[model samples]
Target: MTESDAATASLRPTDAIVLTGLRVRAHHGVFDFERENGQDFVVDVTAHLDLSPSAVSDDLSRTVHYGELAVEVADAVRRDPVDLIETVAERVAAVVLAHEPVHSVEVTVHKPDAPIEVPFDDVAVRILRGRS
Candidate 1:
């Protein structure tokens, strides 16, 4: 395996949590109509934490509560008026990393129905952040 692959493979089995397809209506875009009209945005997050404690203790307190995290992300996305998905992804990552259990997070913000002259499937931005 490559060095990075080997390093990732060495981590424990339950060390990460993934949340996907979190859709919300948010007012973020470069164009005025986009901000005014608002559009649906989808977020997918992978949070890295030491999940062994939760696994062994069988305690919810030992891990990040994904439902609450999803709501937090949705609420944040709905309120912000940012111009770029990159900014949205960064903001979401910061929130996830704020959790005590989370050591790092990867956030992807997908704008599937973005405005464009030509046809396309989707547009998105992804970012990775580690606790500091």
Candidate 2:
């Protein structure tokens, strides 16, 4: 199959297209030191929906506005200090699900600068939500 054919084939009415590793700085952690000394956070978002409208119309309006969604996630992460990445992920997923077009949402919050004694890349939490 050609590239265009593959692209089309990959899309489905219920398929989810994921945006990963979206880095944002936010104060999230259980330690008091972490909340006080804010650190960089990374987030991944997956939006599940029907892609047929955007696929056919080739119009931005027919699809979930990823740019707007990114901003919303960032804003939610920064709004109030959280003590855990789990809480951040849960909140972000809730916010994304509020968008009507999104049938389901998955959010992952990563904290690279977690206050662990051993060296580590990061710690993260993942949460999933779906419309009823």
Candidate 3:
């Protein structure tokens, strides 16, 4: 599919797998400590694809293997050091959408302990990408 196709693959109730609260310690930030000392980043991913094939065959191979997908996401998050959460989210989305069944990806990166001077509960960046 083209970029537009992936971009327009809106989430539907029937064919989506959601993973949430997958926290990992990663060095991603604009400041020195962010890369050097690192921090906890919480990732939430929604993978959109047709589940009918898997549903009919009752085969794990027919669907996205979320267990392996989670590992790939965590590795992507913790391994590389980026200055922006947007990049991080994109990387995660790329991994999720790599599967043929996944037409689109939704990634949310949470920086709860962001180095903000103001008092706040959390900060996060969310993005959606379609198959490229």
Candidate with the greatest lDDT versus the true structure? 3
* Position 41, candidate 2: lDDT: 89
| Each prediction's TM-score versus the true structure | 0.87, 0.83, 0.90
What's the TM for model 3?
0.90
- Candidate 2 vs candidate 3: the TM-score winner is 3
Expressed as tens digits, the lDDT of each residue in 5-116 for candidate 3 is: 5545444334788999999999999999889999999999999888899999999999999899999999999977999999999999988988888887789999999999
Candidate 2, 58-126: lDDT as tens digits: 987888788888888889888798777888888888888887778877788888878889999778888
Give Cα-based local distance difference scores for all models. Answer: 0.86, 0.80, 0.89
Q: Give Cα distance to truth, residue 96, candidate 3, Å.
A: 0.6
Candidate 3 lDDT score at position 90 = 91
TM-score of 2: 0.83
Identify the runs in model 1 with alpha carbons over 4 angstroms from their true place. 1-14
Q: State in Å the error of residue 75, model 3.
A: 0.4
Off by over 4 Å in 2: 1-13
Q: 10-90, model 1: which lDDT tens digit per residue?
A: 432347899999999988999999999999999999998898899999999999999999999888788759999888898
